[model samples]
Target: MSDDDGLMLNFAIPDNGTTTTANTQSKNVKVRGGRWKDRRILKLELEGRPKEKKVKGPNSIPIDASRKRRMEEKPSKPKSSQSNPTSEFKRAKFTETKGEHGGKNDSYVSSLFTNNTASTQEVPEESKEETKTYLPSNAPDKNATSFAGLGINEKLSKHLTDHQRFKYPTKIQKLVIPNLLVTERDLFVKAQTGSGKTMAFILPIFHKLMMEYKHKIGRESGLFAIILTPTRELANQIYSVLENLNRCYPFLVPGIVIGGEKKKSEKARLRKGVNILVATPGRLADHLENTKTLDISQLRYLVLDEGDKLVELGFEETISKITKIIDDNSKIDETKDKWQGLPTRRINILCSATLQNNVKQLGNIILNNPEMISVDREVEGTILFDDDTTGEVQTNNEHESFAPDQLIQSVLIVPPKLRLVTLDASLVNIANKIEQSGESSRSIVFFSCSDSVNYHFDVFTRDGKKFKKVKDEETGETKTILVSPDDSADEDQDDAELTSPIINKNTIIYKLHGSLSQQTRTTILQQFIKDDPKFPHKVLFCTDVASRGLDLPNISNVIEYDAPFTIDDHLHRIGRSARVGAKGNATLFLLPGLEEGYIDAKLKIVHPREENLRVTKYETILSSAFGEKNSTTKNKFDKLGNWDIHATTWHLEVERWLLENSSALAKASHAFTSHIRAYATHLSQERNFFNVKLLHLGHLAKSFGLRETPKNLGKKSSKNNDKFEELENGGKKYKKEDPRKKMLRLAKLAVNSTSEYNY
Candidate 1:
């Protein structure tokens, strides 16, 4: 038997008997076997013919003898039932039957011999199962899902997808879609910029628009949705987002109405029955004023983006007006008949990075028990991670100690006249420090007023004058003479040539104030952020105008020429720096005398009346002696030597008295009463301290007399004692010298230590 033939035999036959047959016959062998223990063996086959010979002997092939004997002893083949045996045999031979392998082998044989067809069959099953499991069970397959999956119907889905947004919904979309779909509940969502917050609201409103379009309901002859933004720039941005979405979905048409843009086009679009309107309150209010038939009674959803800024920009009044215009129900008289179609229940949504008290109040009036979502801290983490691309958080401790563990505060005292000079020197020194330390170039200088800003600008420019030019001319003769200019000009030109050109050479410098025309302001601002190829950094010198709602990219430094009056303003100013994951620097310029303004000025003369009285009496005596009233001898108060009468009098009358009454007990004794009265009299010389009354003076007299009992003093003493204790404790916590108080005391000391003779 050959390997190709499907046969296996285990038998014993005679092998030793030799016979030469004249006629040789080939016998066909058929084996009938039970199922094998190893099923894999059934697939094997044998091919090629076996040798044809006759031999008589016991076969040497090993077999189970008992099984073979049993098989041999089994009954012989049964007689055929059909009379035409040959016909039956032919039919049986031709007909297909199960081979020894037990099942049809066609499929297995074909798979083994085929090319890529085998792989194709196996791949789709696993892929299909994987894809099925990957999709969220509650929603349809994300890949095949339309905007409908995001709560937007087919009409909106077409528009949104047409805008090339063919993917899974963003995180904000996932949270907002269902809420907007199910109810008109007010939503407050706080997400970072570029987190797709605009789409979150747009898509849901799109769904509502499509619903209204399809059902031919809720038309109400008015706009359906109104989106209020803080700035014209932001309003335009939101308009663009909706416009793209509207293009994708034919049912939606959004119009933008903001300041510093073409009004006619926007008005025309709005008149054409816009489903959504994105606008700034000021401009939209203007439009509503002119167009009496501008109906918004159907306004269903109101979105206020950057809600904090809207209030900060003084838009609350305008916003209220616009909302009142749209909310006809609020305006209608109770006695009058109700409008034919107006939405009674409107949804108000407000979004902002920060929520202030005014914003909260606005929300209370506009939104109905709205939910508040705060992403400030969470977004900070995202920003930090974004800034740390190398996966290592950078510490800003070396320059400005943001770390709580290590803090160092310094106090600098400079004369008022030298303030500008000191500030210039300090900036240069700080710049040097940054360079030497290889730290980031982040620093800011805070000025107290706009005048100081101009002063510093002038000082800095003057300091940079060594890099400027100068010219010199030689004396000329009678005839025409050509004189060469000084080499200094060439040197300055060379230095200027060597110096690096300003990084933002084409940057437009603009001043932002409330007085600028809206058009001029818009043009300046647009130029500042114009994204021109030639310029990148737009330097803006503003007076708190750019503190809020102005989102500029790549701002590395914030210079506060003046310190903010309040801590909140300080936070807002520094906030302009270190925004959107960028490192920033802030510098504060404080002059010596400037700090004294924050502190109460102390009394200069401790015994002004007594001192003046003594001087007056001396002048009287001098006048009596000198009949001529000599100018030099008029007072002798001036040009007083170290041992002069005035000096001696001041020492004995003021310093010595204060020293004797320095102790608390001594100060409370009867002996010190006269000194207290005299000091009080002196203090009263310039102006009465706290309008001290005779009764108050008597009380002071009694306080001075109570030496034995320290606690016997009235409530005033107790309050003083408590304050003293607090000061003492606070002083101990600080260094031996309280830098702030020391600076103030030093200023007072400087004034007191000066002499009238010197003046």
Candidate 2:
């Protein structure tokens, strides 16, 4: 009837059923005065059906005697209407059996009609099955547009395109660019390494620079951006990235300031004005101290890359100093009036892979209320890279697939006297294994300490010696080659000299450690990464410093000559080889009881392994030098098993004693006396003496009186007020000395000391 009330209907009938009426209204004609009345009426009826039917009686009711007899013989059903048919049913005729049948059929047909209409008028399948779409809580809304999509200003886009990053924005960039483009707020971002974090802040700084350029804000007085990193290499890396951007853009200039490089040249670059400056905190501070004219008053953006490592490497003090000089709230602002009157207008950005406590504290001091964007934690181990051209993807290699299942991690438990020889032999065995496996050129050897790094480097290089031809006096520039160990001579003579060619040619070795100059370190690392096929096999002797932050693409085997201090460190060492879907092999050499001690100590730090790793015992090259039947061999093996237990017990006892008697030994003099008393007691018991001798007492006193004695007084005594005087004196003496020289000296001293000390 109306649009809202409109309803469609349909009907169906059984094939066996007879249709009643085609049009009910046509039969509703009413007669008035022998003619159809002029009024509309409706009626319902069955078509061509008789109103009534009746059956004729059999002739004379079969009154014959035979008919009556046959009827009587058949069983007859009882008929009752209170034992008799009602006279009212015949009179009314409406209670007939035909009427009852019609009523029941009408009710059944009505239900069938209703069901057929409902079935025919059902909604379409596609319309009924439609569903609403759901999106993740953290994902950007579908309707929202990103900074890049919103017609980013030409200058900003130009800078981004120059860096070859003109595609979609990273999560951090998408969240930060809008806020930074309008406001100057310090941001502290905690993100994984390879998450495009560098470009997040860099893009915004470029945008600000472009805006300033468009507005014709004349040349700024100081650097606009200052980026600090923990190491020289990282600073250089950032510098390289920015330099590439400059090369592509042609208008921007970037400067790098780091240690182990020229300062005057860096200062010269700064005087010329740079849009961005990347530097190590220490070197940058040094430059700031030396060059008063190189002001950073115009510094707008500050970025700390790898902030976790900056704190780890103890650069917090330097970072604080640098920040204090730049920030408007710093006490150093008293000297600001000496420079330009421009306001600081600074915003700090911190990026780190992991947020250590110290790093968080530092960020709290530097950044304002910050927004946090974290990629799923589970997906962190999965490294994702997009192809610039084809947009293909890749994933990291799982450790299980890369490492061999049957490769045993064993420790060659050698006595302290033979530890060096054991290490040497282990290196040789690893080299041989790599060569035999046909992958020696892709193997790496890890050493614990720098000294060991140099030692193994020398040994391996010597073992794989190559000689060049030289002119002989008799032969005048003839090409006569000199063989290693003088192999051209007798065997005894060859062996007598510390020279051998057989051990040399099979392996090429390189050394790596923190102490090496950055140039040397990078060169050696690059060479290792580019291990030539002609060489077939090369060995890398490195300290733990090389274990992390390096992507060695072709390392097939990793030899842990010295066991790692913790399981995480061990995993990181082995992780170097088996990366980005490559199979790798790892072997460890544990000197007998060394495994137990490391395992016990390691469990206190990292998650403990459910079961101990499989370890195999190898015959010590040193132990075999003696006769196999010697009692010394048996005694040595027995001692090796008990060494860890004895050492642990002794360490625990010492720790307990220090904790209990620390207050009594607060004074340096008192701590020294205690050390003497302990040593005297040990000597007395060992010598079976009832009392200490004057000579022994004198020796103990002298040992305790040495300058190095205070370090042996344990943590508490070293941390006490008495040691403060020694620290202060040392600091003041080196206050005027070169900080680098002092740092080197202190590092060396720390390395050499076997005892724990505060300073």
Candidate 3:
């Protein structure tokens, strides 16, 4: 297959379930990262890793943070004889956190913008309008025959077309796969979430493992490929993908060993000698310590899925221990008494949706002569600052194919006070639609925490005896029930009007959170993924645990019941539905009504969003009935029962807020805060350091939609034609005065020219 760019693909692969042997006799065949560049990979011959005694098992791994040595800041001024003034580049020093860890004080807490009342600022006409999207690349080609065209083995290509049915390769897949086969470089892949990144690394690693195994250079076998991810669910998902592909090459056995699963079972699987192991770091380390059958000394390929998340301090110790154990022992022994040793050489692939600086640092530690490939622009390890003019917003690479083209963004006005009741309404409607269509509906509702998830689950499953609504068998009448979102156990059983809730049919809801046992979560995921027409878990309420790496198929809608805290979270949460070139819908519910605090919350969401995502927009669907200060929502009482005056009022208030503030609310995360966390309050200790704040007046202006106002020239968006819009009388150009000239004219040479402060 060839694209319009004239890029031809090679699909010839093995049809028989047979492994190809590597020709060891071939002389110095070109390898990618194996033939390392001096500058790309730092030589450790004279900088050997600190020597340590051999760790017999995982039990020997230390949990303590590895001590990091800091290079002291140079003295302010070196003596004249020792000073050098000609250095071309300078580096900044790391900040010191030595004394801040123990201090707990209320001095830093401030209600930066806790507005108690409503305030409105008229936005400029130009500012009120949205910007036009810029497409820099030609449209994607969907006419490709199969994955084989992208250089896959023929059998694999046929399976892709006949089984997986992926007719074309994604942008990252096209860029990554070809390079992996042709070049022998360490891989650092940063594709957007849901971009089929798992395959990008898996295929290459599988191919290499097969080739290397055929040549027989490494030891007669243990696991050849080890995929380490952060969470259990993610590990399972990666394992599933690997298992599916392994069917073609029946010789390869893939297994998963994640936390919370039985270690005995894991050992049993390992005892059988699996060809590939997908695991979470903690458990893998544990088995490595206690289990006698586990061995990875001959490991050929090491893949870090969601590499950015796993490279953090929390998992750093475990990862370092694992890598050290797998590192060649002979090379280390050669330099045990000296500071010289050979670098550990192995195939390393690090993958993530967002590659921050810390993740880059991790690549330096493990990868040699790595090729850094991303589907989008750069992301960060640290926060961007208001004064950092060098920083740029996340841009869409016109060529990137990971972003779902048909993803539509929508917002449903909802109040925190009536969140559950409103959720019930949404679910009831969704179920009705699914029944009418005779197809299963797949929707994920994201919450802020596990507590919220549990609370909502109870409400959904609760059979009302007290707070539950009662229905008349003959008249078909029902009663409104009000249950606290936080405490679903509260019910007024004594009320004669309140009756047991009629069973809601076709409402097969599943809950996923960190608190759920690994086995239970796995079961729930299985039921949810069940595509059988008979019964399926349709609705899933979860936290961020399900956001990053889990790929649930046929997810048609992603609903955020609670607003996301961070911009990246928002992107990943919605990414659940619009995956693998499929169109999907996302609806976010905003909780804060029309108030200043609400706008402040909106600012927190928007700033981060503007930094990394630009091509998407949220449709403000708030109707006048859902307005502010009105706590009542229709709450679909007509469907369940007569709505409580208060619940109905609150529900309407949510709509009113959205309707009244549509201009601000439509910006999605950038324009609102719908959910509030307890830790966000000033009374919370941990809230002090991470609370969002406006850095400067210009930042505040930008957040409030005044970024393009005449005076705030510090920031500008291409679509803000402020000057053009402000033109009066035939679009005549106004002679603008330079501030520098104005300052000079107003100052009148303040001091005597000869006696100025400067020499």
On lDDT, the candidate that comes out on top is 3
The residue-by-residue lDDT of candidate 1 on 613-689, one tens digit each, is 01011112222222232466743322222112321222122222332345423433322222222222222322322
* TM-score, one value per model: 0.40, 0.46, 0.55
Minimum summed lDDT over a 10-residue window in model 3 is located at 750-759
Report the lDDT tens digits of candidate 2 across residue range 1-759.
325536332222223344445543233333222112111111112232222323222211224555556767988646544332221121111111222222233221111001111111111122354333222212233355654664457655655556554445655456556656665556656443333566666766655554544333323434778898766655655676676655545556778888777778887887777778888888888988787656776676788876766765677788878888776433324434532322345677777655445566667556654444344332223223343474343434221111212222333433322333444445545555555677544667776565445534433344344334568889687673536643443544211112223234455567766667666666666666664554666667776666543545677667786656434446557756644333455666543232344434443232222211333333333222211233556423332232223222222232223334443223323534333322232222232211222222322222121212343332222233334434646744333455333433343343333221110
- Residue runs of model 3 more than 4 Å from their true location after superposition: 1-141, 211-220, 329-344, 377-405, 412-415, 464-504, 532-537, 593-759
Model 3, 1-759: lDDT tens per residue? 334446443323323454433422222222232224421232221123223333221113333323211213434655342242211112122121223221122111111122211113211222456543333111234764346766777877677667874667777777777777666567777777777788877886666554544343222346667899887788888888877887777666788888787778888889888878898888888877788787775566788887766764257778877887778422433332322111234568888766555565566556665666765543212111222264332222221223444565555433233344455555555665566677776889887656456545544553432234558789999964445333344443111111113213445567787766676677778867877564332678787788878889888878877656544566678778767766676766643333224324433343233312221111111111121233356332221221233234333333333335553233322221211221132122222322323113232222222212124221211122334323322566435566334322222221111111010
When sorted by lDDT, best at the front, the candidate numbers are: 3, 2, 1
Candidates' RMSD to native: 46.0, 40.2, 33.6
- lDDT for model 3 comes to 0.52
By TM-score: ranked, best first: 3, 2, 1
Q: Candidate 2 — which residues are off by over 4 angstroms?
A: 1-222, 328-345, 376-444, 463-507, 536-538, 544-560, 563-749, 752-759
Q: State the weakest 10-residue window (summed lDDT) of model 1.
A: 116-125
Best by TM-score: 3
Question: Number of clashing residue pairs in every model?
Answer: 30, 13, 35
